[model samples]
Target: MVDENQLRQWGTKVVDIEKQALENLYQYIDSSEFAQACQLILQCTGKVIVMGMGKSGHIGNKISATLASTGTPAFFVHPGEASHGDLGVLSENDIVLAISNSGEASEILTLIPVIKRMGLPLISVTGKPESSMAKLAQLHLCIEVPEEACPLGLAPTSSTTATLVMGDALAVALLQARGFTQDDFALSHPGGSLGRKLLLKVSDVMHKGDELPSVKHDICITEALYEISKKGLGMTAVVDSNNTLVGIFTDGDLRRVIDADVNLRTTSIADVMTQGCVTITENILAAEALKVMDTKSINGLVVINEQQQPVGALNMLDMVKAGVI
Candidate 1:
């Protein structure tokens, strides 16, 4: 069994302590060393390598990902592995970001001499400015907090969160400096939802050429129904004798005609079809088309040309195929 009161208090205490740690980080942002550190990273010709051990290593990997996605070109390397062979990844043109709370991680300390020998720029993020990690590095970002969020004052919660946020700030600053756009973000994250939204186009998913269901305004209701079945879009465009769009017929209209006992063989599309149907231009984005369909409570749209003639068609299924859904 556990004390509910203690659990609740502990949760709140962690938030308060971590909040203060972040506030402290803000105060250190304007320090001259941060600017110098950013300049060193910005000027590096090779990739930025982030290295850490234990809890710091987890935060460092996320920082490395952020840097890479945001345009700084970075990757994480475990400090302990560098002693084996991973140190070969580092070169004279590269820069290293090493994070250690105590700034005295033995694995990291062991690599200091080799890193110096390679003459690679090293930046340190730590809680102790006086630790060996800070003394040996080219730049130091002190992330010290008076106490841990844990009641035991031993957990790495607040310190690790602060370091992670500081890493995010650095990555975003570089991203903005380089004017990295959403299009650029899509390049690396092509399998994700955001990439799908930015990379997909209307032409990639539209039913064009012979695949489009189309009927002239004077065409009989039976002919329109046949086109709908052949095209499998559940809808067909009704064009005038002059080859201009005038109306549309869908499954809903078929149901209404059946309920009215209208003769499908005798009734013309011009009379039974719904006039002034919702339409989308061929040039519009598929995302915009999706919004239009949603707002209009329609499942499909007739893609019309500049001459107001039916050129193509698409349904919600097309959006799914294009990855817009």
Candidate 2:
């Protein structure tokens, strides 16, 4: 029943309308009212409680999550639920961010007096600045869109997009003000790739003890090749008599020896090995190791301890498996 061409055209048109709607948010976010809202949230001693009804409630939930993840403590409470018993979640130290496109949602209006009684600061996000919800709140940020993307003009299209963008603007402004760092963001998202990159250390995902691919510096290239193959790291660490890393031999070294026509069975690894190779410490983050590998254009690294003793080994494969690459 659907024409593919018409459907494609409709999708493109909707995107254009919402894109323009987001573009229009620049003025509202730069307004003094937006600054006041950010100040109130930044100074709050307790959590931000976002309240809304229906579609507004959905956007409120997302806004609450974005704020919480970006160094602001916040959560969502439906206006209808607040009236029954959820208002217990509020306290004197808390601030309220209520969202209603029309600015006159009855459920939100009904909670205004209770919020005031609790001595909570109220911030309203609405399209109608003159509506009761905006007029009664202590701080108001307007999200007025030029037109809806819906052909029928009955659905919330551009207006909801504008509200979401405005919420993102507020969250980012607060994030910058607090100097929130990626490490702080990682604390809340430990299961994601960013967390792995930020939190995983070299010792946590490296081959240690007997698993380390190591050979004595005086060993023949053929013997070093056996160690590299057994350890499956495409390389081997060349250690001195005291088991301190003195050099490294890799597949690339093997290629150069072959090109020079040096017999693998007769040549000592020290003659062909690379001295003073790039190394990492056990306590450094895996991401730092990746950066070193990238800068040096290498695939593996030797992890050292405080006394410059080789304690572990890791390659790009380990970084990939740990989600750090």
Candidate 3:
């Protein structure tokens, strides 16, 4: 039978070893070479072309993606493919970032001549500071780890983790240097939830025109209830004779009237409707609208124009459907 305690110990040991590896990474990050790399990327007008072999290639791909999304345009190019005519992608204005744990991947070394011929600055990321690839490059970012988390010292674990963290550090530092904002991030990820929360506006999700539930202030409670039911928004805007918003009546108001023993058939909505209720503009972000609803402890809001006319309406369900809740 498998020993459960042994398995737990092994897992804990791996985590501890990897943690130490990351701790060793701090010294490299504080080095002058790291600062030089950031400056090189910032000065380059072209994309960062990252190249690597095997496991390093996987980490390189993710690093490239992070750089691109964080405002530093970059993409990965396998060193093996570069030797097979993929080198055509290289431009004189581009910068090459090569990743190799040993800094001696033959595939990457083979492309050094062509990259040098193009006059592109090369940045190397490796565990060996004295290795050929590191010595050949204009700048080197060291990712040397004391030991591998793999018990056999063959599979890359701590090394890859350190490389990933280094790439993240570069991307974030550049992002801050460029003054990147949430709006800029939203532009790159418009389909994501954060994008929706930042970009979606009340006009994009609120029910407008005939879909809006509204009734005159003189309408009886029973009539207002029918409008609310027909609209399916659980509430109706109470408007004056000139079609300007006066108040709002909701299902909660109906319950209150019932508890008070009021005759819904005879009572006018204006008598029970909440006056000067919370309202929003169509141009405001849905996220901001959510904040307003939360602060007021309300479930819905009436959208009004400059003239105080009811233009649109939305509720918590609408916010949910819009992915803004």
lDDT tens string, model 1, 96-140?
999999898999999989888989999999999899988888999
What's each prediction's TM-score? 0.88, 0.88, 0.96
Candidate 3 residue-wise lDDT at 23:
97
Q: What ranges in model 3 sit over 4 Å off?
A: none
- Alpha-carbon RMSD to native, per candidate: 2.6, 2.6, 1.4
Model 1, residue 89: displacement in angstroms?
A: 2.7
What are the Cα lDDT values of the candidates?
0.89, 0.93, 0.95
lDDT accuracy of residue 68 in candidate 3: 94
Clashes of 3: 0
List, residue by residue over 34-108, the lDDT tens digit for candidate 2.
Answer: 999999999999999998888889999999999999999999999998899999999889999999999999999
Which 10-residue window of candidate 2 scores lowest in summed lDDT?
Answer: 302-311
Candidates 1 and 3, the one with greater TM-score: 3
Which whole-number lDDT from 0 to 100 does residue 23 have in model 1?
89
lDDT order of candidates, top first: 3, 2, 1
lDDT of 1 at 7: 86
> Cα miss at 263, model 3 (Å)?
2.3
